[model samples]
Target: MTNDLRARRLALLKEHFASEVAQEFDRTIATFADSPRYEIMPTGQVHDGEDQVIAYHRAQRTAFPDQRHENVRFHVADDDSIIAEFDLLGTNKGEFAGGAPTGKAFRVPTIAVFFFDGERLVNERVYLDSASMLRQIGRMDLLG
Candidate 1:
């Protein structure tokens, strides 16, 4: 039963993210209804609903049309939560998080823990080194 749930959740994530974000299907808003509230930590940016998530992704896709997220690992917890590691790659072509356009390509590693309520994702807490991403895009001088 757990395996079935995991498979279903994974399938949902893959279908939503892959088709909506990766393929630029333009129906991202509708797809977000099945997703959890995603909060980008440290920055405290919260995308609460499917509409907001789609709007957020629309802007993101416009900025980095070539952006892609690849899931590298996934683990299902005893409580039905899921932990995933992924890589986000993209070329900066527009403003991001108040950072000016970098016009550079970047690859950043990220991890996210997703909590589930029944079959739907309730919340997703992500962890990543945004500083490294900034450095990769030549925005941060910390590594220089």
Candidate 2:
């Protein structure tokens, strides 16, 4: 029974990412618990509610509408939280972080630890290299 539950939860998580890669924001929104959150570690930013999460997604996708994860691999933790490692691929075809597009592509290695309460996802803590991403996108000069 426990294994069954674990598989179901993991399946839900994978499907969540599938929706996100498809740019199905509404579907991505449906995957969360009522008050889900995302903590982006590199940027020290947290989107703490559904609205904030929506805005964050909008901003990112607006900048890189083709953004997606590739070579995804998932590891199930002892606490049932799934840790996802993937390559974040995207082209900066639109404004990002209030800066004009460089129309460059970046491939950033990323890891996102998904936290769950029972079968509901409560939080996702993402670890990524902002410097590498910025440099690839022609924004390294902004790094000072």
lDDT top scorer? 2
lDDT by residue for model 2 over 1-113, one digit each (tens)? 28987888888888889988887877887777778699999889999987898899889999999999999998888885889999999999999887999999999999999
Candidates' C-alpha lDDT: 0.71, 0.89
How well does candidate 1 score on lDDT at residue 133?
Answer: 77
Give the Cα-based TM-score of candidate 2 against the true structure: 0.95
Which residue pairs in candidate 2 collide? none
C-alpha-based local distance difference test score of model 2? 0.89
Over 16-45, each residue of candidate 1 has an lDDT whose tens digit, in order, gives: 567655555454333333653778884678
Off by over 4 Å in 2: none
The best candidate in terms of TM-score: 2
* Model 1, runs deviating above 4 Å: 23-36, 98-100, 141-144
Clashing residue pairs in candidate 1 (N, C-alpha, C atoms within 3 angstroms): none
